[model samples]
Structures are given as C-alpha cells and as structure tokens.
Target: METDLLIIGGGPAGLHAALTADRAGARVVVADESFSLGGQLRQQTQWLSNLPGQYGYGKKRGTWVNEQLINQVGASNVQVLKKHTMIGSYLNGNIGVSDGDKTFEIQSRKNIIAPGAQEEAKVFPGWTLPGVMTAGAAQILINREKVLPGKRAVMVGSNDFSLEVARQLNSCGITVEAIVEEKNQIICSDGELVKTLENVPVYTNSTIEIVTGAGEVEHVVIQTPDGLKEVNVDLVCIANGFSPILEPFEIMNCHFVYQKELGGWLAAYNIHLQTTNPSCYIAGNAAGITDFGSILLTGEIAALSALEAMGFISSAEGTEQKSRCWRELANLESEKVLQARTEMLADYHQKHELDLPDYFMKIKGGKMYG
Candidate 1:
C-alpha cells in the first residue's frame, strides 16, 4: 500500500497523529495489533487528567476520550487496519505488516511509531497463579470484558494508576484488601489521583514477600515498614508501572539513549519528535513516560513534523503549531520529565553535531548514561 503517512498504533497517540496528518491533507493509514482501536485506553474506566486543569477543574473518562478519538478518526479520510502488526522495516523504507494471515508492505512518505508502552510484570512467589495479573489486565477484565477478576483483591502499588484500579475494582463490588508501595510515600504524579482513595488503605515502604493460594491468589504477605502483614484476598494486581515498547523502533534501526526518568531507553528525538531516522517519528508513552495530555500533545507535534517534512504544510506554520503544543505540554508535564526531555534533545544534537537551540540547555544533575 502507498500512503503519505503510516501510523503504527491505534491508541490515543496514533489516532491523534492520524487525525492531525489527515487534516493536513495527507493520506494516513493506522495499523494496530489489537482487534479494535484505543489500545489500553479502551480498558480504562477512571477519569484521566488529559487536559490541563482537568485533574481538579474538570473531568474526562478515559473511555470517553478514547471513543471520541475513534469517532473523529472514523469521520476522517484516515484508513485503519485493525489487527495489523508491523513486523519489520525495509532499507528502502517499506514497512512489513501482518494481520495474522499474510504479510503486506506499506510504503509511506513518513511513519509515526506510537505503539505505546508495556506493563512491567513483577514476579514473586505465587505470581504464576491464574489470578495474579497486572493492574492493566484486571482493568480490562472489569471495564472491557465486564467480568470481575475476583471477589477480593490485594493491590501491589500506590501510584495513581494502581489507586484508580483499586477504585474501579471496589466499584465492581470487589474488596481491595490494601494497596502496597515500595516507595517511602505514595508515588502519585499528582495528588488529585488519591482524592477518591481516601477510604482505601495504603502501605508505604512495602513489598510483597509472597503470595499463597491453593489454585489462585488467596493470601498475600506484604513486608511493610512495620513488618510482615498478611492479607486475605482472591486476586493480586501488580501495578509496578510500565516500560516503553521500543522493539518495533529497534527493528527500524533507530538510535536510542537511556533516560531512566522517561521509562528507560527511548529513541533519540528532537523538539519536534523526529527520531534519528529523519522520516520516522515517535509519540505517546513510546516516546517517554508522561501525562495523557502531554502524550496527545507529542502525537500532534510528531504529526506536524512529518507533515512539514512531506511538504503538506509550510515550515513556519509547523513551527508555530509545535510551539503552541510545547507550551501546552509544559503545562501538563512534570518537571522531571521536562528536564529529561531537554537533556535528551541536547544529547541528540551534540552527538550529531547539529546546532542546538539557545533555550535548550543541559539540565544540572540529570543522569545521562548514554
């Protein structure tokens, strides 16, 4: 297939990129490995602070945002290839994709890779049990499948995501025994995520010593600051967090640099989200660990960069759009991520001997093992 832009993910990032590029008069094709679009966003039942001030000033369900993106893309000229996965990339720039049947090639002027991130599974005793699952999986069970994972649960994280999952489980009539965090304090990016979990018990500086069950999860032994505490539960949800999925980009031979603050190794990109491969762009969690609002903003910036490169829009127009997006992104993103991003771009330009922007300065005390 021939197209102007090929977006390799149907999640919020990819969908937003497709919409942006399509609106810029480019023929867009979105390929996703799932049977439907929205990726993990479809499984989310809690409200996401996607827009600035929405965390406290307003509300938006993740599912509602997902559906809105899907509907908007559906109404556009963009074509979607559900159940399609990108297998590899050719030296000539043709991408190989498969829908579990036959492999086909897509040749596009630019590619936006936004396959998102993967949940990190924490393995402990009894983790192999049938009922032991990630928070994301449990969320899918309750929200998408409309089925309860278990009647009782022990959550193993104290982040906003885990707290939200615990709230969702409680809403489904599942008893959440407790939420455990290895950190000294609750690791919430924002305090707003905990407003709904006031009644739920949270254990700080805790680790799951072991999980005991006959066939499924029945009890969890958590090593808290005070000592070991036993809790009875039929299910265990591990929400340790996620790592960016970069294998697809690795197959494309994109250069990477380690930035632990951004969720480990990430494809090196500029302010416009263009990777080392000039024609290839990245967005969303695949680019870095950030807020939903910043993820969507990155998607738009990436699409605009690609559109500018493809001559669909003037360079000045692209710059103006991206500058506006960046300003909004700064308002939505965390200071740590912002610092990491600035350092990452500085390193990218330094390695390539490219001129760095005057405003782009190396962040003090930032780790760069690359």
Candidate 2:
C-alpha cells in the first residue's frame, strides 16, 4: 500500500495526526496493535488535569474524546488499521506491518511515529509470580476487563499513578493494605487524592524487597529506615515508570535524545515536530511522555508540519495552524509543571530516593540502555 502520510500508531497522537492531515486533504493511514484505538486511555482511571483549578475528566470522558476523534478520521479519507502493528520501518519510506499471519509493506511520502510508551517492570526475585503486575497492567485488567487480580493488594511507588491506583482499588472494595513509596515524598497532592490517602496507609522510605507466595503473592517483605517488615497481601502492583517504544524509529534510524524527565530516550524533533529525517515526524508519548492535552496538541502540529512537507498544504497555512496549537500546548505544559511542583512539595517534609533493586537496574540498562 502507498500513502501520503503513514502514521504508525492509533493512540491519541496518531489519531489526531490522521485527523489533521486528512482535514488538510492528505491521504492518511493509521495502524495500531491493539484491537481498540484509545491507547492507554482505555486503561487510565481518570483524565489528567492539564489546566489548574479545573475538574479533571475521567476514563469515560477520555473514551468519548477518543471516539469523537476516530469518528472524524473515519469520516475523512484516512484509513484506520486496527489490530495492525508496524514491526519495522526503513529509509526511503518503506514500512513493514503485520496483522495476524499476514505481513504487508507500505511506501509513504511521509511517516509519523506515535507508538507511545510501555510500562517498565523491573525483575525482582518473585516478580514472575502470578499476582505481580505493573500499575498500568493492573488498571487494564481491573478497569477494562473487570477482573480483580486479588482481594488484598500492596502497591509500591511514589507517583501520581500509585496514588490513583490505590484510590481506585479501595473504592472498588479491594483491600489496599498500603501504598509504599521507596521515596518518603508524596508525588501527588490533589485535594481528591489527599482525601483518598487519609484512609489508606502511606508508607514512606520503604521498598518491597521480596514477594513470597506458593503460586501467587501471599506476603510482601518491605525494607524501611525503621527496619524490615512484612505485610500480608495477595497482589503486588509495581509502579516503577515508563519507557518509550522506539524500536520502529530505530529501524528507521531516526535520531533521538535522552531526556530523563520525559521518560527516557525521545525522537529528536524541531519545533515543527519534524525529526532529523525530514520525511518523518513524531508526536505524543512516542515523542516524549508529556500530558495528554500536550499529546493532542503535538499531534495537530505534527500533522500540519507533515502536510506542508508533502506539499499538500502551503507553509503559511501550516505555520498559522502550528502557532495556534503550540500556544495552547505551551500553556497546558506550564500549568502541568506548576501542578506537579505543588504536589511534590506537599510532602516535602518526607523525601527520599526511589528504591529500585539491582535486577531492575539491569532491566533498565538492558532495553533502555541509552
């Protein structure tokens, strides 16, 4: 298949990119591995608060937004390829995609990578146990599949995700024994989150050293400044962090920059979202782990840039649209920083380093060795 613009992802970024390019009258194709197209929003419990002093939307709202975007793209000439995964990309605009037993090749005038990020699970001694899972995976199972992994769970992490998962589990009648943060700091301080923490025990400066059970997680051993302690729990949720899925970009030899704050290595792109390779662009978490609103704005900007590059639209039109989108994105990012700072400082009285075992260190160094 040949297309004017080939977008290798169906998440918010890829969807928005298709919409933007299609609206500009460019031939677009979008592919994603999942059966659905909402990306991580399908598992997320609530919408991220991008603007301060505003009530954040929930998963349902996110679903509605995703559906609306998909509808718009589908209404246009954009080709939606759900359950199709782009396995590799090559120079000269050649791409390899797979769907079940079939593989297909596509040539495009331009490509946009938006494969997004994946949850990082560092291997601990008993990490392979049935009840162990990443925070995102657990949410996917419980919120999406409506399957409870366990009756009692112990969550380990000190981030907004950890707090949110704890609240969700408790609200669903699952006994969350405690939320353990290797760091003694509180990473989220939204009024709603704080209210949830009032009931769940928050353990600071602690690490889950070992999880032991016959076939599943039954007890979790934690190490804290005080001493070693054991908590009886049936499930353990690890909220380590996220790493970008850059395999497709690597295959295309796209230049990337390592940004610790943005969840590791990200494609190097200009203000227009054009990568080192002019024929390619990247946006959303695939570009870097920015907030959702920023992802949407980046998608729009990247699409306009791609359209201009392909001569489907004039530079003046692309520039005008990009500037407008960027202005809103910048404001949203600024507010996100303020909110993150406020949340970080709320538990300033207790701050410590992240507790990661040596094995996890090996895993991080292995896949994301960059």
Candidate 3:
C-alpha cells in the first residue's frame, strides 16, 4: 500500500497523529496490531481530566476519550488497518507488514512510529504459575474483557500503576489482601488515591519470597520488615515499571539511548519527536514514558513535525501547533522527564552530526551499536 503518511500503532499516539494529519489533507493510513484502537487506553478505567484539547476538567474517562478519537478517525478520510503488524523495516523507507495471512510492504512519504510501551515484569519464584500476571494483563481482563482476574488478589508494588490497579480490583469486589512494597513508604504521590488502599494492609520494605500454588496462585509469602508473612490469594499482580517497545524504532535503525527515568532504552528524538531518520518520527511511550495527557500532546507534535517536513503544512502553522502541545505537555509531565528529554535530544543532535564509528554494526535483536 502507498500513502502520503503511514502511522504504525493505533494507540493514542498513532490515533492522534492520524487525526492531525488527516485534518491537514494528508492521505493517512493507520496500521495497528490490535483488533481495536486505543492501545492501553482501552483498559484504563481512570478518569482523565485537564487534557489539552477536546477534554475538560472532570469531563471524560480514558475510555471515553479513546472512543472519541476512534469515532473521529472513523468519520475522517483516513484508512484504518487493524490487526496489522510491522514485520520488517528497511533503510529505504519501505515497511513490511503482515495481517496474519500474508506479508505486504507499505511505502509512504513520511511515517509516525508509536508502537507504545510494554509492561515490565520483576519475576520471582512461581511467577510463571497461572493466575500470576502483570498488572496490565489483569487490567485487560477486568476492564476490557469484562472478566474477573480473581476474587482475592495481592498487588506486588506500591507505585501509582499498582495502586490504581489495586483500586480497580477493589472496586470490582476483589479483595486486595495486601500490597507489598520494597520501599519503606508508599511510592504513589496521589494522597487521595493512596487513602483508598489504606484498608488494604501495606507491608513496607517487603519482598515476595515465594508464591505457592498447586495449579494456580494459592498463597504468597512476603518477607516483610518483621518477618515472613503468608497471604492467601488467587491472583498475584506484578505492577512494576514499563519499558518502551523499541522493536519498531530498532527495525528502522533509529538511534537509541538509555534513560532510566524514561523507562529504559528509547528512540533518540528531538523536541519535535523526529528521530535520527528525518523521515521517521516517534511519539508516545515509544519515544519515552509519560502519562496519557503528555502522550496525546507528543502525538500531535510528531504529526505537526511530519506535516511541516512534508510541506503539507506551513512552518508557522506547525510551530503554532507544536508550541501549544509543548505547553500542555510541560504541565502534564514531570520536571525530571522534561530535563531528561532535553539532555537526550541534545545528545541525539550532537551524535547525529558526527560520523558513526566502525564499531556501530548490526547486533542481535535488531539493536545496533549505540
């Protein structure tokens, strides 16, 4: 297939990008691996407020916003290719994609790659057992699939993600027996939300020594500050941090850098979300890890950057949209992430100007020498 612009990943970033580009009269095509759009937003039951555009304070749920985007895109002229996965990427700008039946290549004038992030797992003994899964998996089961993960659950982290999932599980009538935190205090900054988990006992400075079960998760032994405590639960939710899915960028030969704060290795890009390959832009968690609000803004910025580069939009127009998105993103993102991004962009630009060394050869897993 051939198009003016191709967006990979129908998540928030790619959906927003498709809408932005389509509005600018670009023939846009969005290919996603999922049957439905919205990516992680589909499983998010959180209330999203204070977003930059089309959302007001206490107005929209995450799924509602996702639906709005989907509906808007559906009403537009852009083409949607669901259940399509990118299998190969070439330096010449041709992308090989598969729809489970056959492989095909797509050629586009410009591309926006926003394959999103993957949930990180901290494995322990018996983690491979049934009913033991990542927090995201549990969320999909309850929120999207409309199925209960377990009647009794134990959340294995105290971060915001863990707490939010715990809250959701509790709301679904699943008894969150305990929240085990290796840190001395709760890591979630939302005081009000943390209060929801107050009734659910929190074991600070605790680690899961083992999870025992016959065929499913039956009990978990946590090494607390005092001693080993056993909690009986059917489900074990591992709510660790997330890591950017870099396979898309890696296949495209995009430069990568390690930024621990941004969720490990991510594509090196500029303020405009343009990677080392000028034709290819990245957004959302594929660029760096941030909240949903910031991810939306980054998608707009990336599309604007691509539109300007393709001469579909004026420089002034692109700059105006980007400035507005950046302003909103600044408010939604953390100071640490913003600072780290500044450093990462500076490094990317500096290296982009220099010649690559001989050691920069193709490595396994599609990751080249950095």
Candidate 4:
C-alpha cells in the first residue's frame, strides 16, 4: 500500500492527523492495532472538559466532541487498516504493518508515528497473578468486555484516572477494598476529584507489599508507617503511570528525550512535529504522554506539516496555519507542564523507582520489573 501520508496509529491523534491531511488534499492511510477507533477515551468513564480559550478546549470539550471527531474521521473516506500493527519503519519512509499472520509494506511520502503509550506496572509480589491487572486493563474489561476480574478490588495509585476507575468499579457493584497511594496526598488538582476521594477510603503513604493467593489474587499485603497489613481482595489494579511506545520509531533511530514530566522517554519533535528525520513525524502519546486534547492538536499540526513538506499545500498557507497551531501547542504544553509539576510535588513519587516485590524474581527470573 502507498499513500501520501501514512499514519501509524488509529487513536485520537492518528485519526485526527488522517482527517486533517485528507482534508488538505493528501491521500492518507491510517493503520491501527485496535479493532476500532476512539483509543483510551473509549475506556474512560466520563469526559473531561477543557477550560474556555484553551488550545485543546474545543478539540476535546465534551463527549459530543469525541464522538463527532471520530465520526468525522470515519466519514472522511480515509483508508483505515484496522487491526494492523506497525512493527517497523525504514529510513526511506516505508512502514512494516502486520495483522497476526500476514504482513504488508506501506510506502509513504510522509509517515506519522502515533503508536501511543503503554501503562507501566510497578512489580510487586503476586502481581502476575491472574486476578491482578493494570487499571487501564481493568477498565477495558469492565467497560468494553463487560467482565469483572473479581468482586473485591484494591486500587493502587493517586491519579485522576485511578480515582475515576475506582468510582466506575464501585458503581458496578464491585467492592472497592481501598484506594491506596504511596504518598500522603491525592495528586490531582481537580476539585471534583478531591471531593470524590472523600467518599472512598483512601490510604496514604502505603504500598502493596505482597499479593497472596493459590492461583489468583485472594489477599493483598500493604506496607505503611503503621506496619504491614493484609486486606482480602480478589483483584488488584496497579495504576502506575504510562511509558511511551517508542520501540518502532526507536528502531529507526529517532531522536528522543527522557522527560520525567512526560512519563519517561518521548520522541523529540519540533513545533511542526517533524522528528529527527524530516520524512518521519510523530504526535500524541507516542510523542509524549499528555492529555488527549493536546495529542489531537499535535496530530493536526503534524499532518499539516507533512502536507506542506510534500508540496500538497502552499508554504504561505501552511506557515499561517502552523503559526496558529504552534501557539496553541505552546499554550497546551504550558498547561500540562504546570499540572505535571503540581502532581509531581503532591505525589513525591519518583518515576520507575518503585520497589519491586521479591515474588517477581521467583516466577519471571531475575528480570527487573518496569
């Protein structure tokens, strides 16, 4: 397959990129590993609204915006390769895509990498047990698959996502044993979240020491200043932060920076979303772990940049559009950085530094847990 613009993800970012480029009179193809579109928004319990005059405000204002954006992408006549996993990219702008058994090579004049990020689970004893899962995974199961891992659950994290997921689980009649944070504070600045946490039993300065069960999770041992305590729980949801999925672009030697504020390593890009290699662009969580609204804006910027670079759009128009987009990106980046600093200060938890339980070495060899 060949396209003027090849988008390597189907999430909000990639979908928006495809739509933008297609609207700019460029042939676009979107390849996504997921069965459908919408990305993480599909798993969220409620929509988050951005403040007025905000850069990404209108992009992700409400539930209607998400639905409308996705519908627009689907209706744009964009060629979507659903369930296609892009395994690799070459220097000459060729992408390797696979769908389980078969593989296809897609050559593009310009390529956009928006593979997104993956949730990182800080290893603890019995973490690999059948009943234990990431908060994101649990949400997917409960929201999409209509299956609950267990009745009683322990959620470990202090982010807004963690709290929202806990609320969702509790609403579904799941017994939430407790929401534990290794720190003493809730890491969200949202006033609504703070009020919501008051209703749930929240344990501060605590970490899950061990999870014990015969073949599944039956109990979770937590370590706190008081002492070690055991709580009966059928499920444990690890809500550690996410890490960028940059392996595909890394193979292409794309330049990246380790930004602790952005949840670890992120591919480096300029205001135009051009990566180290000019022919290859990146956006969304694949570029960095920011909000969905920012990712969508970046995707649009990246598509416009790619279209301009490919001679599909005049330089004058591209420059004017890019200037407006860059201002918006800068504003969004500022807001995110502010929130990130607040969360970091509030949580006082270091990234990728959580102590792993001794049990992880027993089952999975001596490999270090992420």
Report the number of the highest-lDDT candidate. Answer: 3
Q: Write the per-residue lDDT of candidate 4 for residues 280-311, one digit (tens) a residue.
A: 89888877777666677778879989999999
- For 217-329, candidate 2 gives per-residue lDDT tens digits of 99888887888878898989988877777888778877766666667776666666767677788888876666778788778878998898889899777766776665556
Clash pairs of candidate 3?
Answer: none
* TM-score preference between candidates 2 and 3, better one: 3
Question: What is candidate 1's local distance difference test score?
Answer: 0.85
State which candidate, 3 or 4, has the greater TM-score: 3
* TM-score of every model versus the real structure: 0.93, 0.86, 0.93, 0.85
**What lDDT does the true structure give each of the candidates?**
0.85, 0.74, 0.86, 0.75
* Residue-level lDDT tens digits of model 3 in 198-269: 899999999999999999999999999899999899999998889899888888888888999899898888
Q: How close to the true structure is residue 285 of candidate 3, measured as C-alpha lDDT?
A: 87
Q: 244-346, model 1: which lDDT tens digit per residue?
A: 8988888888888899989998888987798888889999999998777778888998999999999999988987787667766765677788778877877
Clash count per candidate: 0, 0, 0, 0
- Worst 10-residue lDDT window for candidate 3 reads 360-369
User: Would you list the clashing residue pairs of candidate 4?
Assistant: none
